[model samples]
Target: MTRTESLANRLQEVLLNGRWIANTNYKHQLEDITWEQAIKKVGSLNTIAALTYHVNYYLAGILNVFRGGELEIRDRYSFDLPPICSKEDWDNLVDEFLTNSEAFVLEVSKLPDHKLDMPFVDEKYGTYLRNLEGVIEHCYYHLGQISFLKKLIFA
Candidate 1:
């Protein structure tokens, strides 16, 4: 398979799910964590809630730009960290996160091969691959943090 195809497939496996491996994904370190447990921040890192928001931020940010949505920072608030004091709120945010993630994956899958080589510059990351793989990497980076925070809050 082509590099983009491989990345797209794996990204679907990891990010399309409604939630991360919290104790349920056997190989995932944070398995078994309750959603409530996912929202608490026991240390220096952002709570799973915040990390999830950041993931959504990049997902929406990239997808939006691909769809002719502007790259202005002010317009990127949909993915910013939100307060996660209650289970319902956390559930809602998580759902939104999943929805955006799925949308991003689908969007990236449709990108033309040439478009992948294009350059995109913004305040967030100065230069980036203008395609699906970059989006997938951004998602994985934040997911790593979310999974790590899950361990702290739960295990």
Candidate 2:
């Protein structure tokens, strides 16, 4: 498969439905979690709701650039999730994440293989491949945290 297709699939593996990598995807991990459990604090670690919004924040920002918009996401604000006070709030965040995840995957899948080697946004950010891979890696990193937090909160 082309690099773009492969990257898109990897993204799916982490955020949506594939399970070969972490044995769990974001959808599987977040679907059953209630608003209370999502916002539960496990020691000093970030809540699942925060992490979910965090990853989706980047996905959405980067996805904007993919659609010809400028890069506008900042690391400091990645976790600035608004209060999820009810099931509706949590569900809305998950819905946004899922929508952004699907859109991100679609944008990546549509890219030309040659674009993978081209600079993403700017040279300093590295190639499209690098950014795409970074998103996948970043998601997995937080996914691990979310999974661990889930166990801790439930235990």
Candidate 3:
């Protein structure tokens, strides 16, 4: 498969549904979690809800760039999730995350292979391949945190 297709698959694996790497994807981990559980504090780490919004924040920002918009995400605001006061709030966040994840994957898959080497927004940010891989890696990193937090919450 082309590199873009492979990267898109990897992105899907971490964010949507593929068990080849972490053995758990974001969808599987967050689907059954209650709003209370999602906001539960597990020591100093970020809440599941925060992390979910965090990753989705980046996905959305980059996805916008993919659609020819400017990059507008800021790291300081990544975890600035509005309070999830009810089950409906948590569900909306998850639904938004899943929708953005799918859109991100679709954008990546649609890229021409040559675009992978092109600068992503700016040369300092590195190539499209680098940014795409970074997103996958970033998701897995937070996914691990969410997994561990789940265990801690239930323990």
Pairs that collide, model 3: none
List where candidate 2 sits over 4 angstroms from the true fold: none
lDDT of 1: 0.60
What overall lDDT, based on C-alpha atoms, would model 2 receive against the true structure? Answer: 0.93
| Candidate lDDT (C-alpha), each | 0.60, 0.93, 0.93
Per-residue alpha-carbon lDDT of model 3 for 14-96, expressed as tens digits? 98899999999999999889999999987788999999999999999998999999999999899899999999999999999
TM-score of each: 0.71, 0.98, 0.98
Model 1: runs farther than 4 Å from truth? 1-3, 17-35, 74-80, 121-132
- Sum up the clashes in candidate 3: 0
lDDT of 2 at 137: 91
Span of 10 residues, lowest total lDDT, candidate 2? 146-155
